[model samples]
Target chain A: MSSYHLDHLQHLESEAIHVMREVAGEFERPALLFSGGKDSICLLRLAEKAFRPAEIPMPFLNIETGHEFPELIDFRDRRAKQLGAKLIIRTVDDAIARGFATPKPGIVSRNQLQTPVLLGAIEEFKFDCCIGGARRDEEKARAKERFFSFRDSFGQWDPKNQRPEIWNLYNARLNQGENMRVFPLSNWTEMDVWEYIKKEQLEVPTIYFSHERDCFRRGGQWLPVPPAHTGATTPDPYAGARPTEKEPVKRLVVRVRTIADMISTGMIESKVHSFDDIITEISAARVTERGSRADDKASEAAMEDRKKAGYF
Target chain B: MSATISHSRPPVSHPVDILRFNTCGSVDDGKSTLIGRLLYDSKSLMEDQIEALERSADITGGGQINLANLTDGLRAEREQGITIDVAYRYFATPRRKFIIADTPGHVQYTRNMVTGASAANLSIVLIDARLGVIEQSRRHTCIASLLRIPHLVVAVNKMDLVDWSEERFIEICDQFNEFLPRLDIKDVKFIPMSALNGDNLVDPSVHTPWYVGPTLLGHLETVHIGSDYNLNGFRFPVQWVNRPNNPTDRQLHDFRGFSGQIAGGIVRVGQKVMALPGGQTSTVKEIWTLDGPLPEAFCPQSVTLVLEHDIDISRGNMIIGLDQLPGTGMDLHAQVCWMHQRPLQRGKKYFLKHTSNTVQAMVTEIDHRINMATLVPEPAPAELVLNDIGEIRIRTAKPLVYDGYATNRLTGSFILIEQGTNATVAAGMLLPSEQLVRPESGDYVI
Candidate 1:
């Protein structure tokens, strides 16, 4: 008898593919939430595996913060085109302009504002399920999430009232106007994601690799210096007042551990360049991956609060 | 110089195989503390995490760095000092990675334990040495047995409280052995440890000089889980039919394949397979993966199998090997763990989701409910209340192809979703067809 076994990466891949295929089988109208981050990038690969010879039976959806890195947006668009899948983008800027969402004065982050926009997109498209890349190991609130997390008609997640998911038998049955946020990567940890990326040789934005860019120190972390003469002095839209004499900016070598909006995503000063380097850094790092995102650092339960409002 | 550099690096280069296990015990059995010690002693806890643990010590643990806080992530859980939900934690050593499903010990949250144990390869049933083998410990052990977990570790926790007496550990082990023969579990091991003081968790404890078994961490890394899955009977429930009609790509154009994660057994190219329910037989032309075509695929691998002939097959169909066919029936007898607050009454309809197939099913009869305290079946009750375990008969609208839960975990288990509320109300394990016939059938009144 021959023994058959899968390594950790292969096992995670198989589990993720199973989840993606379940979403494809159960839901009538489902969309993959592509954020162009490492997690979402892995989701695209899993989606391809789930449906392959056939185009993924769903479109790709992204709720943009509008302050996102140009490289990430470019990569997201290019990947969607390469897959020949339709990409639907709903922006927080558009939501604010249309009065559907109000930006908290002096708070430049559209992170909190993303909830309404995401819900709006769901309603407009009648997407019964939106596949996300949220991992349980990322945050405490996420650790409690079900693979097929239920959302009410108002797109609110009641953590205390989630349905019990057992084995691989997920209950994808939802009433009209109610939707589910499906996380195929629920079991994947940051190291697992990086390992899968290396094993699969998946493509991600170049920002993840080390590069020299004009950056400045704020909140004890590096922030990219916006291009000169773009007329935006402050990186954050709600950064109360323009610094008296623009906080000293310098060109520094940095890399991003995670890709979020420029105003919130922090840069790590490192010479690490390749996937192996990132993996080694993560294995020895002191802080959690989300620890770098200033948005999550705002409050202890920031992610939990946003999730309750249907933020992906 | 090269040899010195290579020797300094860890022996394993790529990612090691993962072991998923759950810890179940009453609130004070030190389940969370055991997990905390495992991570902390292994150097898995980050520096900042340690700092945060120290900072929150004053609020949650009265100035002592509480290890239980590592698994209890919810605010209410921390405030109440109890685990509320199943929190997953990850840690890795050089040999293997591990995913720990820290389930709450409260009896009301038995559904969480079932959910966690459903995917776990092994289950750790913690028992307090001072209170050797309590009712909660028995209940959790019975649940693990019912779930058919391959391995069970009876961690005799808090040995330090009992003066590290080998007699106490042996007594508890003998007590567990007395009732364990009634269950279906195999590969049971007992380890003595103090989760609070980190004795025998990751390192050898000086306190317990007589114990000879491997430490908890060592056992986890070395357990033989490679044969956990069934490899004889091939079963693939078609999740979706992949049909990418891209004109630009020749390879994708006019391609059709049945895609799903293989539930059991092995499938290879040119192997003759049959699609259940439809009874369509065809030869496997190729097994496709993201990388390319594979020569063969086995259980738990998600792959697309191309058939030699195009059949009228779609989602909810199972592809099986010709040798050992699964039982097909509309009437199924199963052991169900009721999860909802509302009692499971006879004649209530539900959406029975098994594998990728969902069918309308109604409870025909409730045979008996097992008393977790005694591990005995109490003859047919009025209805199964929340967290009640009982055997019941179900009649589905469509015939389902399945094996007994003891044979194949993926193909044999299902969940019942309430029709109106859409809440998953029960997790059910199907019994073999021979056991499906009710002994009371002859006593039925005309």
Candidate 2:
């Protein structure tokens, strides 16, 4: 009888797989939101386990910020092509150029700029549902999110009035224009993701491993310095990214804990190169992964405010 | 009896199991505070989270940090100083991983409590030691029982307010036990503690010299939840059909499998199973999980099952063992917790979602609504409004395979989605289908 027990990782994995299969079965047009991050990398694996021996039913969608690491974009393309998945990359640069999004003054992050591009892609593809790698453990606002979160036609989340998800049954019904953002990994924490990646031997971007890189200190976080631009015709995207003269450029051996925009994501200085070392470091870590993310530090309710405004 | 032990190396740690439980109590009973203290004392709170709490504490001025802000993420919730919705919190000790469903305890939010407890193996009901047992306590306990939560912990919080008196704690325990026998829950524990002062949460408090049981965290870590799911009856609700039909890959060209999470019991390769409604029997050819092919699989593990013979089965169909068959019928009697602003009445139609299947269903009759205060049934209420739990009769467009709610939570539970709005209006738990009294004439007879 003891053999019947599934470990915590297995339990979380089973739940996530169940959710992915539900999306495949219920939705007429669904898309997987893959960002080339560890969480989304895990999402791809879950999708494989869910409908393998067959193609993943949904296409993959990505909202690419122009400031993203070149390595991440390359990895994203490679993973999609390897799986024979249809990768749809919508860009914030395109949205800004088309006047769909207006940039805020002094804000070079482009974090908020991705929301419009995502909504526009949904409209372009007429997707009824978008499965994301977002987990409740990621943010406080997410803690109250539903498994099958309903969004209005504008992709806005109404935090106060979420559907009561009872048992394992989810209500995925939608009117025209309204779509749902389904999160299969809602119960998983940062530790669960790392453990799963280890168990499945899933490949992640090389930036997660410890390496020496040119970096700068700003707002008490280590941000990687974007590679110096050659004489390309366009302006440097990394310019004014540091925001203040007090932030000094320095070379540091650091590794990114989370894969977001290169400008917004922060790295911790450690010698953690292997998965075991990473897991041990996380076990003794004192700060949440998002603590280093400057975007979340914009305000106490930054994530919640952004979530209500249709940001994933 | 000579044995040499290797003292140079540490033993490799086994994987940690998960425990899902919920906390429910009245607004001021310290539900969120208990959760905050548990996470903090368990060393689960990260540095950034503590900083965020401190920042929010300044805005919501009390000069003292309010631990509730740790969970009340929404601006409205922070301003109002109340938990309006269910928030899930995750923490882990080396021994186990825990998922805490922090639900609001306001009377109007009974629907939220029901939603939180729907999937929990255990429920913690917080009682204010100064106030003793109140109507809200009874209401929460009744709900935990109605939801069939296997374990209950009555944490008498704010013990410092009552000077940590053993007599006061015992008196509160006595009050809870007076109504405990009326409920269906089997395991119940009462503890005295203060969520504010971090007493009896992670570590046993020295103040409680009279109480000699495990601390709240100790009990949570060691509670028996391995047998929570029904293992005697094999039930699988097919969610999707896996097929490749790939031209390039030879082995996948003619593949077809039923995919779903096992709802009950265990299934093995070459086992005989029956599909509901059609009643066609088939032999299981293979059971494949993400890891690989498995000789056997049990409840709650998702797998793709290949049948030996081609059969007519699709989503919404249940694959089950030949014995301990579930009841099959169109008439379903259930207790539902109404959720929408619109009241639930007879003649209203809804999309009844049970397991993986959704079928058109109409309310045939409203039998009775349970009075939360007295734990008695009020016969034939006019209508079940929001947050009201009542017994109702339903007629589905097609037959549903189900067991009683007491028998299986996964198989017996359902949700009612409003047709036009597509809003989930009710959470329902099916009563024993065998108790459905059918009329011989079938002419709307009661």
Best by the DockQ measure? 2
lDDT, residue B383, model 2: 96
Off by over 4 Å in 2: A242-246, B1-15, B435-446
DockQ of the candidate models in sequence: 0.62, 0.64
Candidate 2, residue B219: Cα displacement in angstroms equals: 0.6
**Among these predicted structures, which one has the highest TM-score?**
2
- The local distance difference test score of each candidate is 0.86, 0.88
- What are the candidates' C-alpha RMSDs? 4.7, 5.2
Please give, for residues A47-151, the per-residue lDDT of candidate 1 as tens digits. 888887677889999998777788999999999999989999999989988999998866767889999999999999999999999999887778889999999
Which consecutive 10 residues in model 1 chain B have the weakest lDDT in total? B1-10
Q: Write the per-residue lDDT of candidate 1 for residues B1-446, one digit (tens) a residue.
A: 00011112232346468899999999899999899888787777765556567767866566788888777777677778898888888888888889999988999999999999999999999999999988898889999999999999999998988999999999999999999988989899999999988899989999988998999999998998888989978999999888877799897786889999999999999999987777767999999887889999998999999899989789998999988767778889999999999999799899999988999999999999999889999988999999999999999998888899998999999999899999899999999765221222322111
Candidate 2 lDDT over B184-246, as tens digits, reads 999998889999888999888989999999899999999999889899789999999988888
True contacts kept of each: 0.73, 0.86
* CAPRI quality of model 2: medium
